[model samples]
Target: MHSLETVILLLVFVLGLALLAQRIHLVFPILLTVGGLVIGFIPGLPRVVLDPSVVLLVFLPPILYSAAWYTNWSDFRQYVEPVIVLALGLVLVTSLGVALLAHSIIPGFTVSMGLLLGAIISPSDAVAATTIMKTQSVPRKIVTILEGESLVNDASALVLLQLALTSVTTGAFSLENALLEFVILSVGGIGTGLALGFISFCIHKHAKLEPALETVLTFVTAYLAYLVAEHLHLSGVLSVVTAGLFIGHKQSRVHSPIVRMQAVAVWDFVIVLLNGLIFILIGLQLPHVVNAIRGQSADYLCVYGIGISLAVVVIRFVYIFMADTVSNQIRSLIHRAPIFPSRRYTTLLAYISMRGIVSLAAVLSIPEKLPNGSPFPGRNLILFITFCVILFTLVVQGILLPLVIRALAFGQPSTDYLSRHEVQKQLSQRALRQVQRLIDQDKLTGIAVQAVIAQHQMRVRELANAETAPLLDQHQLNQKLMLTSIQAQRDELINLRDRQQIDIELFHEMENELDRQEIQWHPVSG
Candidate 1:
């Protein structure tokens, strides 16, 4: 009863915080964490601890799939070197560094436990990365590297974390078996995701599903990959991401206009709610985690937390200078020219790797007891430390991320966005040329062809404003004239209504007729 009430109040508080975030044009992740910090100390407020199983099994798949679906495959592949370095290479480096640092600095911390904690905090959050990229004038390639890293790093970290947790649980560790497990699970998850994606594509392309049913399939597809991979003891995170990448890449060719429209709206709504719930849940769990760590001195814990946090920051900078060495060596063996990103790119990459919800969830999900029924050693401390790292990265690193980006001063305008605009213009022009040829051959007539060409011209204007898009052809000129006449009629109708020359019902009837004709001549969206 009290627990249920506490849950409701927390959700209500999250809702209010979201509104405040929008009002101030602030990032919601930071604000929500701050909100949680505030509420956690409010005396009499019931402590709310998130169920780890619910966080992993229920909350992760959809949100993850949504991120993967929106990821640009071309960008991911184009920056493959840096992406791999950060996602796989950097994760391994950071995990090992944290493990060594924790074991050396903190008393009674075992290698396995330190490894578990390291993996938990190693992932740079997809949400935080995307938010910072959007809020700043960061270079697109830099954004691409961060976003790509975010997509795949979780799989690396989580798999490592699980292996560590297994070591802690059963008191058994084998390098040969662990290596085999990593290979098989990762390969199997990718294979399963590809198979599910193919099946989804076949259904979407051949069945001609209605928008509603197709939208339902989108949700089902996200969960299906997750369930299948986890069932097979594979990496569910990778499976969901792989499947989403497949379907999203094929969206335009497999789905109709209406299906695409409906799916976007539904997915957008689902993602927003999911992100809000996730950060809010993260905030609400802090006080409970803090209160549980009674074994350690408060001062000791804080100092330890600061040390771990600093290790995370400093290690990234140190590692950044070293990571590309792998790529450089590979290139050298092949006799290719050496390539290194500017120092600014390296610095921005280091700064933007902010931790968030998944880290907290991973630490919280640590087993309550070992195989012999003893309480998991240092579980509460691990949870407290993980929360501290998340707060520090999400708040401190996240806040300073924009400054680093601005200082990078990547003088080039966003090449990706400019390239997209150019591509759209070229495509629109090509489409117009084809339509004009049809009219020239008399397969299409004037007003009808003019209407389509006008639409294409409008598209061109959208990519490049009207002043810059080429001067209108005769057909477009006539189309614009027709729209002008229609606007005149709509205005006249409104004037008649205002003067009471026609009843309200009659005015609407006449206006609707004009609207239909207007749509026929010029289909412009406000």
Candidate 2:
């Protein structure tokens, strides 16, 4: 088969596996990583080549943007200090710690090489953490803190990585200059992202395009922001993230529902595919990495991998505990200060530091040669170690995370029924208001007003009855049966439309009524 055709087939297969795995309540991200590893071992599979620059440019933007856009900005702002500590401060500390350890432990390894390795894996992958944590019923605050930290940490890590790499390449290391450059890059990146976001937002507002067209524009915006930031020698990851956050927050107010829905679906699919492909690429590169270390003691690679992985894991645990302690103490001193609310939730957040595609991509990006025209020391070993660490965290840690939550009794009780009821109540109230307004404005005559009022009153009564019903009792079995019947009918009608057995206009009219009825029955909260 042609290379492109082969890749298309592989992606289709991976997506199929993802769907099946999700059905059984397995985590899709970990499944993909494992699938990639298994596929990599197959001798005849096409190799997945990745240029570090291309990986960063392609994957980082949409992933970061999606996290930022969906993130609760208010919560993120409230917990900004802790997020910064985890994202920026923790990344630097981890990098330094790893560098020091590697320099001491690995024979003939320079501090610069050690720091480069440190920088490569310093930032945890947001996509991995968000995907894994999303399936659990964790508190919203903890989720927000993790999502925010993951989005921004890459910027910090990458900036540090570049500075360290420059020093290593030129044999000139200056702490003062590195610090100065870090500030300039960060400021420049944020400015670029904001500017790009605003420009994209303006274009979306002015152009009355099809939903598909607007979705395309969003894709374009991600890449454009990255390229612009990179050209200006700033952190591309930060720039794309900022633009996404800006656009996502404003998208709802500006775009039509059709555009918003279409864009969200498209972006979601893109991220999944991109993430899957990255993991697959990591697995595919393993053969080459192993070949690079051939004739060397495989035992040494094993030890090195274990040591580095342990270092990364231990450092994160220590850093999270320290940071949370300090943050809690500070919050305790101020009466008006917001608290994290739950220590157990915070600990779960610490355990969720699973590294995935981004770290692999960064490790894969290591230069082939150092400044002295010799091969970069332990480059293959680093890649091997990184892949091992990612697997251990993503597969081992990912699988065990739920058990940890359960052991700690961290899962929030299911709120699905309450949420559904709340929605129903809000819709019923809205409908009543609309009918009353019509009568007041003389839009309905006496007979029409009475008929409308009767229907509205009936809905209100039904909602009230449902609200007062014992949640776990079978006394209101008939009402529950009726609700299920109505829902089933609605689903059947939707299926009919999907099967092309109904016309669009008729389907929509019926669907709207069904929605109204469902809303009245469920009574959701705002």
Candidate 3:
């Protein structure tokens, strides 16, 4: 099939699977992966080989940026310590454990080679985990830590993979140099991200670009962060993530509401499409991986795959429990409460070790051949094993995570809803006071002023008694009536435009005003 045709087909496939996934209450990533496998094995279909470099360059930035963009900065700051432990410390430990397992299991496999493989699959994917978690009633802290770890962990794993690759391919290694390089890459990437994020913020604040242009710049900023960091031989993943974090935090203050809304919608769709395509592409790699390692027996590869997959899960479980214990002990010594994560929370955290795009991209990016013109040892096997790990985690754990959460019944009512309600109430009271002062000063006048005061008073009362069922229902009905009135105005405006009673410019201005009002009434839908 031609390139365009192939892309169209993939999109259709993704859309179909997404719908099916929704109907069946399954995680889309798992379904997409399985769908890709089914279609990949279909006879006479085109064999697709993804360019590893393209995957890193094109997909990584936007995906990382989007994840960072949505992450709650306050929550991330609160959980910074554990996020660091998981992103840096746990990643290294998991890599080492997988390395040991691979070295022991595979004949002629060196520790460095094993480390290379381990690093490729060490970082758990946020896309899959967050998507699943959003559908369930998960604790807010778990969500933040997982998101923060995902943002940082890829950089650490990539650094380790690079070092291991260097050691394996060149037959030379230096621990001190490697450590120094990791620091430089991480720090430099973060610096690059901050610099770019500031630049983007200034552009949005000062330039006052229109919504479309501002949205476009977000994509450009993401790519620029990654590309610049990579060009500097730093951690591109870290750069993208940092840029995302800074931009996400500042955009609300700098960018207009239209820009924020448009960007959110665009980013959400693009991320979903990218994620779906990625998983499907992962499944499609099976045929090529198998063909590449034709010499290895099926049974042999299966054993390696199963063993390595099991090792990855076991290592995470062991590390998380141990870390929890140590952290709780220190907190107790300092007279702080033990943070009170029961075994259930810890188990959920451990089970959230699903690997996705980054791991597959890293493994695939491994050199096809060494400098000496020999085939890269176990390249195919490593790819196969990585594929197995991705498949197993996404399919098995993804399916079970929801069930587990349901069973565990994390009963923490979301504090976010209550906080928002309180804030709304406070804002309404302030508005009412301001309106009263304006009337007293004669700065505002007429029936409109009284109407505005009445609206504000009603809002304050409703929010204050938000827990009362009758008042809540009244608020909902008020919103519906307001929306209906807005719709009627919109219809009249459209009718005037159609009958040429109003010029196009006036029509558009009126339409935009209506849109602004609609957003106030139904912010999420708008």
Candidate 4:
């Protein structure tokens, strides 16, 4: 088979495996990674050469952007303090501690090399952490912290990694310069993102186009922001993240429903593909990473890898535990929120410090030759250790994560039916209020007002009935009728707008009202 064909076939197999795993209630990311490792070891398969820079340039931006966009901005704002501590402070502490341990334990390793390794593995892959955590039912606050930490820490870790790499190459380092660069990169990236996002939003607002075209624009915007920022030597990752968050938060207010839904679907697919490809690429690099170690004895490298892995794991645990303690105290004093840190949750959080694609990418990013002309010291060794850490994280930690959750009793009881009913009740109340206001204003009259009011009341009663009985039949019937009518109105509006039968301003006004009505009728939270 042609190499491209072979790659396509492999992707199909992986997708199939993912779907099968879904049926069995298993997480797909872990399965995809394992499948990739197995496929990577097969002989005659084309070697997937993944440059570290390419990984960041191509994959990191979209993934980070999508993550930040979907993140609950309100929750993020509320927990800014803890998020900052975990994202910035914990990363710095872990990097320094790992550097110290690596220098002390590994023979012939320089401080620069140790620090480089430290920076490479310091920030946990938000992709991996979030994917694993999604399967278990955790507290909202805890989940928010994890999500917020993952989103911010990448920028910190990447900045630190670049600084360390530059220091290694130049044979000198300055803390002040590093700090200045961090500030410049962060601020510049955010500025670029906002500028680009606003421009895109304006274009979207004015353009008369299909939903698919708008969706395409969103995809292009993420990469464009990254490329533009990097061309100017700014933080591309941060820029892309900022743009995504801005677009995601505001698109609902600006775009049509069709455009918004289309954009969401497109971004969702892109994120899934990128994440799957990243993990698989990590697995494919295993052999090359092992081959990078030319002079070191296999046994010695294994021993070194083992030691560094232990240090990475232990240091992360200590860092998280300490940060959590400090965060709890601050939260209590400032907000008076209850401090309930489950030991089991903390332990799981500690084990979740798995280094994957990002670590491997950074390790591979080491310059082949230093300024003095000697090849970079222990580059291969660093790669080897990074792979070991990935394995330890994905295999050991992934396998045991569920067991830990079960043992800790961390999964909340399923909230399915009650939650759904509560959401329906809320929606019914909102609809009733809307109808009453329309009647009071003399906008709705006679049969039309009575029909809407009766329907709203029936919905309220059905939701109430759900608390006592399943009410599945009644709920299903109401949902069907409501959705059919919504579709009919949407179709009628589209026809009228296309024919220019309604003035543009009036069309938009009615469409916005319809959108609000649709949202009230079908709340997504539950």
Candidate 5:
């Protein structure tokens, strides 16, 4: 089949599997991956080769940007300590542990090759963990830490991977040099990202571009941050992440409402497409990787795969416990209060160590040949093992995460709804007072004054009732009834269009107006 035809078919497969996943209440990534695997094994199907550069250059920047963009900056800052432990310390530990295991298990594997494999699988995928957490009421702090870890760990892992690859090519290793390089790259990447973000902000401030162009510029900023950092031999992953965080934080202040809304919609659509395609591509690589290492015994492959996967998982679990203990000890020494995450949160964190597409991309990007013109040592094996780890964790751990959360009941009962309600009530009361003050100051007595005061008073009353009732308040009840009525009107509008009683343009205009109304009323909590 033609390449375009193959892509179209794969997109169809993505949609179909996504729908199936929704129907079955399974995480879509797992099902999409399995679907891709099945499709890959079909007889005479076109081989869809995954280009590593395409992944690193094209898909990664936007995906990472979107994740960083949506992250709650305040929560991330508050959980910075644990995020560092997981993103940096735990990743290094996992890499070293996996390095030892890979070196011992694979006959010809070097320490550098082992480390390369280790780094490839070190960072857990944020999307997989967060997607599962969204379905459950996981604690806000846990979610923030996980997101922060996922954002920062990619840079650490990728940097280590680069160092390992260099060591393999040179047949030399130096810890002091590697550490120095790591610091330099990290600092440089961060600086570049911030600088680019500031520049983008300036452009938005001065240019006054249309919403569509502004949305386009946000994507441009992401790609530019990655490309510029990579060109300068810095950590492009960190650069993209940093730029995203900076831009995301400033967006509310710098961007107009229409731009923000449009950018969000565009980014959401793109991220979904990219995420689905990425997991499917990861699955589709299975056959090719298996073929690359075909001569190995089935039992041998199984042992290697299982052993490595187990090593990564167990290493993380142990590290989380060790790190938390050590953290508490240090806090005690410094006379600071301990037990922020608690034991339960630590256990949940350990369970969320599922690897995903970044691992696959890192492993697949291994050089086909070394400087000596020899094929890179253990390249095929590394790819195969990475796939196994991702599959094992994603299927086994991802499936069990929600059940574990329910069993533990670790999520806190959030007060965000009540807080929003309180704020709304206060605002409405303030507005009413302001209107009365303005009317008295101007010595005005007319229909306009009565209209403004009445609107504000009504809002305050409704909000006050909502607070008192807490659940199913008069405001909420009215919201539901209003929505039901709107739905009936929507049905009638469609029927009118079907009967040719309304022109297409008029129908579309009315549809958009209804959409705006729905958006306005949907947030009935406040």
Candidate 6:
């Protein structure tokens, strides 16, 4: 077991590197990964041999939940077709193409082994994609599609991987059975997640706990969705995502002001730290993977890794283009809307293949030996190739994506904030009108209306006049000022902790309160 001090030291290193990454305006995951590689080669530092189980249990649920929580359901539904095609169809195509290539090129690799490897690398990491996209001037629609794709693709890939692994172990493969199982598990996971979400909502509604307890209950909801789904042999990833989406959709109606206030801050804290550690863990495992590849010649390994990486990249372009052509042609024949396939956006989407620690965890989860006690076929080569593909995609594709965007002259930034804020302001006015109706009916006093609706009136007026002001996130003009003050207070608290005027525990509690306040104040559009 790793000691407490070792874990703390690793985290401290991650923190320092994170600051450096921000200072240089580099993506945090990229730089932190490189930092990890550097530390991995050093002789004296303790080897951070992370278990596959740890990453699965600790990192996966929170990371998936965070993405699902922030995903806007309306946008998801509107773009359901494309999201499903990419998340479901593209995953299958990529896996099959990789499997075919691996089975053909690599010596002594079975179809099942190839399938397992393909599934391991198929799911694109949106965190890595977003890190790249955020630095560039990508279009908002492309970003949104990539984000939505990343949220649910793991379910498709993982389920496929499990089936392939079972095939490899049992020396049998059944396509019809796999499809039926996929349907059952996927549907069951969705049902389980929605049921769990309902249970959480009811618990929060009836328990009437304080914000702290409610926050804990929300965490419980997330873990339960994953664990219970897995216990029932369903897709745990999908379950957690489904639950997160359900709760996020109903959040405003169900959660109290205080619960809403605390949940975001708590989740933010959990996700960032968890993600940072996983990246560092990714970096730390480089040596172990490199060592494991000694069973094969380096030349063969490099050729296979680089060849399959290029093939997968090429396959994505082909599949997307084919999907676009086929969908558009069918839609035209049926006299319906086009597939909304922008050439430039499609090109950008094709480049969002940066895999992350998830890939590593999945690859590591492969067993060392098969059921009959013989070593798992091509296991070492799979490990090395998985590592190589991840690094190449993360570094090469990640760094070049922005340059490509610039080349296409399509890096212009856009936001829907102003339009959404205008809509919100309009709704607030209608609400004011409703209040006026109540006053006219003598149900509410006019004086009371004026007192209660001053903020609403100010917001509408500010939005009306703000054609010149740089658009901020909220409809209310004062939101920026409030955020600035909250940030200043947060800094002050950190400074106090640094100066040792407060203990770390006290500092965290006070800082979390400020964080909760900050989150609660952030503008949301319906």
In candidate 2, stretches whose alpha carbon ends up further than 4 angstroms from where it belongs are: 126-137, 336-338, 369-374, 411-420, 427-461, 467-526
In model 3, pairs of residues that clash are none
| Pairs clashing within candidate 4 | none
Per-residue lDDT of candidate 2, residues 76-114 (tens digit): 666687789899998998889988988898787788878
Report backbone clashes per prediction. Answer: 0, 13, 0, 0, 0, 0
* Top-scoring candidate (lDDT): 3
For residues 340-405, what per-residue lDDT tens digits would candidate 1 score against the true structure?
A: 555676777777768876776677677777778898988878877887887888888877777777
The runs of at least 3 residues in candidate 1 whose Cα sits more than 4 Å from the true structure, single-residue gaps closed, are 1-8, 325-341, 414-421, 437-442, 450-526
lDDT of 6 by residue, 97-144 (tens): 899999999877888889999998998888767766666787766766
Candidate 6 C-alpha RMSD relative to the actual structure: 8.9
Among the numbered candidates, top TM-score falls to 3
Q: Summarize candidate 3's per-residue lDDT along 1-526 as a digit string, tens digits.
A: 8988878888888999999999998877788777867877877767677765577777778988988886656567767888898999989998889889999988877888898999999999876787888778987668767888988898789878878988899888788998999899889999999999999889988886777999999999999999999899988888989999898866645665467668878988998888777767766767877988866788989999999999899888999899989989999899887654587778888888899888877886887789899989888888888988988888898888888899888886343322434433443465456556656776655555555556666766777888531222224434544454455555555444334344333444445555666667677541
Least accurate 10 contiguous residues by lDDT in model 4: 468-477
> Candidate 4 on 108-200: residue-level lDDT in tens?
888888888888887776555566656766545566677788788877888788788888888788889889988888889889989999988
Worst 10 residues of 1 by lDDT: 414-423
lDDT of each: 0.73, 0.72, 0.77, 0.69, 0.76, 0.73
Off by over 4 Å in 5: 411-418, 426-449, 467-526
Which wins on TM-score, candidate 3 or candidate 4? 3
Residue 480 C-alpha lDDT in model 3: 46
Q: Model 6: what TM-score?
A: 0.83
